[model samples]
Target chain A: MRTAFYISDGTALTSEAFGHAMLSLFPMKFKHRTLPFIDSAEKATRCCQQINAAASEDGEKPLIFHTFVNTEIKHIINQSQGISYDFLDHYVEPMEAELGIKAQPKTNRTHGIHQDYNFRIDAVNYTLDNDDGVSTKEYGQADIILIGASRTGKTPTCLYLALQYGIKAANYPITEDDLDNLQLSYDLKMHRHKLFGLTIDVERLQSIRQERRANSRYASLEQCQLEINQIEHLFRQEAIPFLNSTHASVEELAAKIMDEAKLERHRY
Target chain B: MRTAFYISDGTALTSEAFGHAMLSLFPMKFKHRTLPFIDSAEKATRCCQQINAAASEDGEKPLIFHTFVNTEIKHIINQSQGISYDFLDHYVEPMEAELGIKAQPKTNRTHGIHQDYNFRIDAVNYTLDNDDGVSTKEYGQADIILIGASRTGKTPTCLYLALQYGIKAANYPITEDDLDNLQLSYDLKMHRHKLFGLTIDVERLQSIRQERRANSRYASLEQCQLEINQIEHLFRQEAIPFLNSTHASVEELAAKIMDEAKLERHRY
Candidate 1:
C-alpha cells in the first residue's frame, strides 16, 4: 500500500484535515502518518529521508499533504520523492487579491491559543459538572440540555459539543422511574426551549445496555422497547425536537443538534 | 465587518476546517457563519438568499468557502452574490490521474460514521472512567497515560486525544502529598513506559487553582512553585518526557504527545 504523510511546522491539524478529507473520496486504503512540529532544517532533512524510504519500500511515490510557514522548509519537503499537494498554496494568492491584504503566514496560527480558549475549557468543565442529570440547578446557564433514554448516547455527544464547538451542553437521562409518569421534570420544563431529545432503536438500546449490565432486566428487549416507546411519545406530546441516534456518529449528532437548536457556537 | 461563510451539504466540518485554516492567514477579523446540512435545492436557494443578504448588509461580496457533493446544489450556491472559492476543485483531477482512479464524491464522507466510530466512543468512556487518577487498574489498556500536577491541563487533553484520534488516554493528577518523595507509585511504575508528564507556569497554575478555591493554601503561588519544582525533578530523574502546557492549546498538546510517544492512531 502507498503511504500518506501530513507534516507541518506546527500542530499539522490543518494538513491532516485536508488529507483526510481528500482521502475519504478514494476507495482504497493507505498507510497514514503524521509528522508534526517539524520546525527546523535538520528535522526537514530527516523528514525527506523518511519520505524517500516510504517511496522505495512501497514502490510508489508517497502522497505528502503539508503546510509550512517557512518557505525554505517547504522547499526541502518538496524536493523529496513523494508527490506533494500544497492545497492551500493554490488559493492564498487569489484570496489575498480578493481581500486586498497580503497574507501573513505564521506557524501555529491555524490551531493556536486564542481569546476563545477559555470558553472551550469552561464549556468542558461545565459539561462535565452537569453530565447525566448530576445537577439541574445549573440548567439556567446551559446553552442546550439533551434529554434522552439511557444509552442513547447523551454523554459522548455532550462532550463532543463542548470540546469541538465550545457549546455549554448538559444532558439528562430518562430512566425507569421517569417512564412511569412520562412527564418532564419542573427543571426541564422550565428550560423547555433548550430541550433536545435523542432516541435509539429498541434493539440498539438493548445491545448497548447488555454490554453494561449483562442478562439484567434493564437490558431486556421488552424493557428497552417500553422505555423508547414512552420517551419518544413524551417527546412528541411535549413538542420537543428529537432525532434517532441508532446510526449517527457523535459528530453527526452534535452538529445536527447545534443546527436544530440554532445555538451560536463559541467557535475556536 | 466583512462576512465569511462556510457551507456544505453535510456537517460542514471540512468546509469549516478549510475556511478557518485559510482565514487565519490574514490578520483581520470577519464575521463568521456556518450553514450546514444544505442538501436540497430549496435549502441551497435559501442559503443563496442569506449569502446575498450578508453581501448587501456588509457592503461587500461575502466570501464563501463551500464543499458540495450535489452538482445542482453547488450550482444554486454558485448563483449567490459572493466571491466563491471552490478549493478542492483544482486538485481532484491531478490526484485522480496520479492514483489511476476516479474521484467519487459523497455527502458526509469526510466526517461520517465509520468502522472506527466505536473505538472513539469506547475511548471517551475509558478516558472519563480513568480521569484524574480515578483508577489505575485500567492503565494496562491505555495507549498513553498523562501525569502532572493538578490543574496543569490533563483532563481536556485526554478528552481531545480520545475524541480526535480514538486513543485511550488516561490522566493522573499529581497532588501535594505526592510531592514529598516525588516518586512514582507502584501502579504507575508498572506502566512507566507509557507515562508522559505535563507542567505549567507557576502563575498560571495558581490562577487556575484560585478559580476553583480562592485564597486557599492550594492556590498559593509559593505552594505551586514548590510542587512544580519537585515534579520537574521527578520527571528528569525518571527519564520521563514532559511538556509545558502553559502556552499550548489542547490540540497542540495532544498532537505533541502523540508524536513523542509514537502511538498509532485509530484514524477515523
Candidate 2:
C-alpha cells in the first residue's frame, strides 16, 4: 500500500478534487492524507517529514498532489521524498498565455469567501426551513421544489443543491396520506412550474426506509412500491419533470436537476 | 465577459473545481456555465455547438475546462471552437506509468455511487437530524460536535462536513440563555473531546442575526458581544479547542476543524 497526500496553503479542496479525479483512473487504493492551511515554512517542513515517514513506512514513494501560492513553502514540499504532481503548474502558464493575463497566484483564492457567500448561507437556511414539507409558504422563493416519497433522497439532495450551487431547493415528501388521492396540494399546484419529482426502486427505498424505521409499514416493500407508483404517476399526469434517485448520488442528482431545471447557479 | 464552461460526461464537479481554481488565479470575471452528464455523442455535438456559439458571441475563444472518459465524446468536444483544457489529460499517462496500471477511463468513477456513498448519505441525515441544537440524544453517534453561538456559521459548516467528508457532524447552538452560566452541560462534558467551539466577531454575528430576526435582542451587538465573551471564557476554562469563523467560509471552517480536531475524513 502507498500513500497519497493533498497538501495546500489554503483549504486544499481543489487539490483533493484534482487528486481524487486522477486517482479514480487507476484500480488501486492508497492511504489518503490531506494537510491544509500549510502556509508557513515550519508547517511545510513538518509536512515534508510526514511525507518521508510515509515513504519509509510503506517503502514506496508517496504521491503529493499540491497547489501552493507561497513559493517558499512549495519549494520546501517539492524537496520531500514524495513524487510531486502540481496539477496547477502545467495549466497556469498556458492559461495565462491564452488569456493574455498573468496568473496572480494567491493563497485562499480558490475557495475564498466572496460577495456571493451570503447567498449560499441564505440558500442553506431557506432549504432547511422548507425541508420535508415542513412549510409550503416559501415555495414562491424556491429555485426548484423536489417532491418525492419518503426515502427517495429528497432532503440530502436539497441540502446539496444549497451547499454546492446556492440553489434554494425545497423538498416535499409525498406521504402515505397522499397515496390515496395522488393529487398535488393547492400550494404545489400553484407552483407547478417549480415542481421536480424523484422516484426510487422499491427495494432500495424499502432498504433505506428500513434503516430509518425498521420493520414499520413505511419500510415495507408493498408500501414502497405503491408510493413510488402513485408519485411517479402523479409526476407524469401533472407533467412534472423527475428523475430516478435509485442510481444517483446527491451530487449527481443536484447537477442533473440544475441542468434539467435550467436554474441559474448563484455560486461559482 | 468571456464565457467559461465546465463540461463532463458525469457530474462535471471536478471540472468546476479545476476550472474555478485556475480561473481564480486570473483577476477577471467569467460567465460560468456547467454542462454535466453529457455522456452521449449527440449531447457532445450540442455541447460543441454551444461552445462554438460562445466563441463567436464572445469574439474570443471561450475557455472550456472538461473531463471526459469516453474518447469519441472527448474527441468531438475537443474539436469545438472553444479552447479546451481537459485537466485530466496531462496527468493520466504519467500517473498510469508510475502506478504500472493502465488507466481505466470510465465515466462517473470520479463521482460515482460506491460503497462509501451510503456513509455520506447517512452523515447528511445525521447532521440534519442533529442540527442547531435540535437534539443531543444522537451526539453519541457524531464523529465531531460543533458548538457555537447563533449566526456564527454552525449549521452550514456541519452540513459541509457531512456532505464533503462523510463525517457525522452535529452542531449545538450556544444560546443567550446559556450566556450567564457559560458552563458545559453534562452531555457536553461526557464528550468534551468531540466538542469544537466556533466564535465570530460581534459585528458579524449581529449583522447575520439581524438578517434572520430583524430587531430582536438576539440581533443586537451588545447581546452578541456578551454571548461571545461567555463562550470564549468557557472554551478556555474547559481546555476546549476553538476557531473563529468570522472571516472563514464554510469550506475553510470545516477544513480547519478537521485539521485541528485530527478528524479522519471518511470520504476520499
* Candidate 1 lDDT by residue in tens digits, A1-268: 9999999988888888889888888898999889999999899999999999999999999999987879999999999999999878988999999999999988778788988998999999999999999999999999999999988999999999998899999999998888778899889999999999999999999999999899999999999999899999999999999989998988889999999999898875
lDDT of 2 at A60: 91
Q: Provide fnat values for all models in the order shown.
A: 0.76, 0.88
Question: Candidate 1 lDDT, tens digit per residue, B79-108?
Answer: 999988776888888899999999898777
TM-score (C-alpha) between model 1 and the true structure:
0.99
What does candidate 2's lDDT look like per residue over A1-268, in tens digits? 9999999888999999999988988889899999999999999999999999999999999999998888999899999999889988889988999999899987888787988899999999999999999999999999999999987899999999998889999999988777678899888999999999999999999999898899998899988888888888999999999999988989999999999999998887
> What TM-score do all the candidates reach, one by one?
0.99, 0.98
State the lDDT at B176 in candidate 2.
Answer: 64
DockQ, in order, for the candidates?
A: 0.80, 0.86
What overall lDDT, based on C-alpha atoms, would model 2 receive against the true structure?
0.91
Per-residue lDDT, model 2, residue A76, is 98
True-vs-predicted CA distance for residue A200, candidate 2, Å:
0.2
Model 2, B70-93: lDDT tens digits are 889989999999888989788988
